[model samples]
Structures are given as structure tokens and as C-alpha cells.
Target: MSDSLSEAWDFLTQAAAEQDDGCRIPGRSWVPPILEDLVLAARNTSLSRYYPFTSHARLRFSTGPESWIGNGDDLAVGIALVPEGRYLVCTQASHDAPVFVRLETADADEAAAMAEHLVNAGS
Candidate 1:
């Protein structure tokens, strides 16, 4: 790993570790896995070349006047792993493929579980 990449990895792992009671919290440091069979740029990249973070807080609200004043709570959550400096968490152009959205939660395990589910649900 290059010095910069290593540093980035350390920073990500450390950030994950520092969390105590939130979705960002992780039981163990995340080591980016190699998805060789997948058609993803992250698959070819090294772990050090990526930065890991939680994608939380997905919300939907009404734009109408009633909703503007008070609306129901419509939200969903998922977590993802993306390459360094990338915004996309994961994508599936294939039909019937499960889309991995960011986890909206305050629990670490829940976020991890969502991430795992995304990996298991392949295109």
C-alpha cells in the first residue's frame, strides 16, 4: 500500500473505531474486500485506495402545503462501501437486482448487516 493509501485506510478504520453508539460504529475495522467477479471499479482497487463510510439518513417528505407543515415519517436506510473520492455506494443495472441504498440508523450492527445484505444481493 502506498503511504497515502495506508494513511487513508488508517483514518477510515480509526473513524469507525471511535464511534460508540451510532450507525458509524463498527465492531471491527473494515477491510475492503476484493470483488473480482463484480464489474465494479472498487473491485480492482486496493483497500488503501478507498475510504469507508456509512451512508445514513434516507428520508422522504411531502412537498405539498400539508406536508410542509407536518408530514409522516417516511425514511429508509442502508450502508455502503465506495472507492476513495466516489459518491456512488453501489449500483445494479440488471433487472430484479437489489439496490443497496444507505442505511439510515443509529446502530452499528444494523448498518453492517445492511452492507452485508447488499453484497449478498448480486446483480
Candidate 2:
């Protein structure tokens, strides 16, 4: 994992431990819903560590036609390999407005697993 990912993972795992429901990470000051969902899913699943990146690049996604506005940032993203499959989740939100997170999957199974998990975890 890159230092940013490791830092983010540590920050999130700690937040989950402290809040049960997550609070924003300090210093960074933004919590895109996809990251929030990941935090909650980690909390729900007892996620305790960070996974190394399979490869390196600036991980970004459009979220396509699903695009909408909200309260914080223009975009944010994260990646993970779950039992279901590899996933790239993205979000766009701003302050005092609605937020939306979109999940991109390497395959349909991952898509199904993530959709179910997001709902089940109440994200």
C-alpha cells in the first residue's frame, strides 16, 4: 500500500473503532460516501488492516451518467479486493448537500456483492 492508503486505512480503522458509525478523518477533512461505506463495511466486517495496491496509478472514475451534485469535493475514490471481487468506488459530494457514491466492479459478482453489502451495512 502507498503511504496515503496506509494512512487513510489507519485513520479509518481508528475512526470505526471509536465511533461504531464513522466520523471524518482528521486533517484530511473530507469523507466521500464511498469511503464512508468502506468504513462502515469495515466496521461491520471487522476489517483491521490495509491491503497493498495490486498496481499503481492515480485511481479515478467518472461515476458516468449517475453523476449528481452534493456538498464537498468534486471527486474521491478507493479500491479493494473482497471475497466477491475487485472494486473501485467513487463519489462526488459537497458541503450541506446530498452525496452519492458509485461502485465499479471488475465483474458482476463483485457488483452484486458490493450492492448487497452497501445496503446491508446501511451505507
Candidate 3:
């Protein structure tokens, strides 16, 4: 893992430890919602403003059409293996939640797993 990624992981881990409700770390800032664009992003989100997320595999971010958005649900956030790029570490928030913490890294599984444990432990 890169130094910056390691730094981010440390911060998130500590934050998760501190939270009593849950470790709701912010996800990568989302771009405008568009279908084709999101599809393309699934393939090449690295080329766009999401160059940072391309490193980690555990996290991913997909800005898409309205239909794809979930109204309210408990989406699982955990470790996952992905292609050799960044992934999104987000929550299933409501419509008005603005995206934040555009995390960029290469070690997704490690980061995501740590986050999951932290979140679960916090709650």
C-alpha cells in the first residue's frame, strides 16, 4: 500500500474506533448521475475525476441514473477483491447526502475489511 493510502486507512480505523453509532466513513465524491457515463465509469472511472480510487480494490463509487439509486437500505460494506484499480467505499444514504471523502488507494480489501470491522465494532 502507498503511504497516503496507509495514512488514510489509519485515520479511518481510528475514526471507526471512536464512533459509537457506527463507522460511517464518507465515500468518494460522486459526479453527476448519468447512465452511459456510469457504465463507462465502471470500466474507466480512473480516467475521470476518480483517478485516486483506481488504486484500491475494496472500495468503489458509481454515479448513475436515478433508477439505480436505492431509496433506503442497509447495503453491505466489507472487504472485496476488485480489478487493479480503486473501488468505492460508500453507504446507501438518502437522496440529499452529498458525497464526501473521495478515497484513492490500491489496497481495497485490506482497507474495506478494516472499515467493516470498525463499523461493526462501533455499532
What is the per-residue lDDT of model 1 for residues 1-123, given as tens digits with 9 covering 90 to 100?
Answer: 232434444544454444322333353424233111111222133321233323332111111212223432111222333322122333434324666544444333443444445444531
RMSD of each: 14.6, 13.6, 16.8
Question: Backbone clashes per model, in order?
Answer: 5, 6, 15
> Could you tell which candidate, 1 or 2, scores higher by lDDT?
2
* Model 3 TM-score, all chains together: 0.27
**Could you tell me which residue pairs clash in candidate 2?**
70-94, 71-94, 71-95, 72-93, 72-94, 72-95
Residues 1-123, model 2: lDDT tens digits: 233544545565454345422323444423222333444454333222322111121122222312333211223333433333245543324334543546766553444345445434544
Q: Scored by Cα lDDT, where does model 1 land? A: 0.32
Ranking by TM-score: 1, 3, 2
Best by TM-score: 1
Candidate 3 lDDT over residue span 19-70, tens digit each: 4123223343232112222223222322122111211223332222111344
